[model samples]
Target: MNILTFDVEDWFHLLDHKSTKSEKVWLNYESRIHSNMERIYKILDNTNQKATFFCLGWVAKTYPEIIRKIIDKGHEIGSHSHLHQLVYEQTPEIFKKDLECSIKTIEDICGQKVIYYRAPGFSITKKNIWAFEIMHELGIKIDCSIFPSKRSHGGFPSFKNQEPVIVSYNGITLKELPINYYTILNKPIIYSGGGYFRLFPYYLINKWSKNSKYVMTYFHPRDFDKNQPIISDLSLARKFKSYVGLSGAATKLETWLNNDQFLDVSTADQKINWNEVPVVKL
Candidate 1:
């Protein structure tokens, strides 16, 4: 009835507007990352559930074995861009290059075509919507790039507040599986589905999902790492948003999996396809 996803990158891959930050530091955590991968591998293996991993191309290129491990375990592989650059910040030319680089790297490592992509920070907004056409040009069929709600990172402040909707982009009809949101009494409420998902009370997440029709959830590998290095100059809000709900992420995930019926994003989309023509009789 829902989809569970993972954005597979370490905590340090985050770009903040602090002093200065660079993703080059992501390459420094080889052993820890691999260990985290193995931990996720074990958890998914035991739970008998598969999740879509929107992996960083940098991670795929640097650790091909980890990418292979994901495929070998029967999980879906999708791109999260080559450098983790925010999509809205780049020119269309640059965005195309970044997306292609990630796609090619992922295909090379997994030996399968990569079809799904989740833009960094969900930065695919109105200003940069042409990027979706470019994605179709490059052969991507599914995009999980629109947050459909506001967040501190980069989100459309006025996209649909509930449910994933299909949007036409650049003469193409690729599925847009926007991230999940919960609205209480017709007002929007943000909960643990990404960073917030891990930070808040797990019971609330369960309750929210139980009351909703479509629940799209995501977490990052970095979330499971309680010992991650803290950002020194992060603003109070950024720091709070990033660190508030981490320690219980893994446990909360296990609980959600045990309770919910989930499919990877692609599979869920296929199911939606088979079930509807999206027309109403007048």
Candidate 2:
């Protein structure tokens, strides 16, 4: 099944290397999350599609009504961490604390247990595989954090498979739905989300989606906002990755949604047979 998800963070929640401002300075920026999310809500409402939103705890805390609105509209809620810290950048203790904070914040706002998670920038790499164990301990049953291919922030380059699998650590097991990628010239390239989704043509993305058995497509609020102020301090490469195809993203997403069916992570999980899936022991 195809899964539609959104990482609910603001324009200022840029990756570390791409951002010049610190968390303490984030309050200075005008928040656009509500309006941008409203745009997304309208699209999903028009299309009659439901998605899972992996929200930052900060966003949840800052905009509790938005969190309630998501649930009110029948969308699933998942945690995207308290802050947008990369998984590998945090120690186990810090990660657990952040996870707990995010879970509590979301649960407090929505009154539903959050069992799905997606790391910021898909940053759960081999170095921090232990984070999964912590997640299991904390009651997260599914993770969409493993970018099977290499990424600038963090990725599981050693994870050769791009499909969903069960990962067992110690005595704990959780389902992993790694971001989708396609091979070109023997190099795995991810076009399902973020900058890649903006950078690639719609036709090519459709082709890749058609070829894959399942696609986990993701979007962010910033992707559809054309008026967001540019981060001038970012390098040219980062600039291109962050802002390229901004004007066309919403159109592309609409076209894709019109042609395909998507399920939330939790619903998609229910449709699969976990026992039959391959297991990766960490």
What's the TM-score of every candidate structure?
Answer: 0.92, 0.97
- Model 2 residue 69 CA deviation in Å: 0.6
lDDT of 1 at 64: 88
lDDT measured at residue 189 in model 2 versus the true structure, 0 to 100: 73
Give per-residue lDDT, candidate 2, residue 84.
89
- Top of the candidates by lDDT: 2
Q: After superposition, how far is residue 224 of candidate 1 from its true place, in Å?
A: 1.3
What TM-score does candidate 2 reach?
Answer: 0.97
Q: Each candidate's lDDT (Cα)?
A: 0.77, 0.89
Candidate 1 has which clashing residue pairs, if any? 192-196, 192-197, 193-197, 199-245
lDDT of 2: 0.89
Question: What is the model-wide C-alpha lDDT for candidate 1?
Answer: 0.77
Model 2 stretches with alpha carbons more than 4 Å out: 17-21
Tens digits of lDDT, candidate 1, 121-237: 788776788887888999988788877677666777577634555667545666677676677787677664666786668788899889887777777787777777787678787
Candidate 2 lDDT, 100-126, residue by residue in tens: 999999999999998999999888988
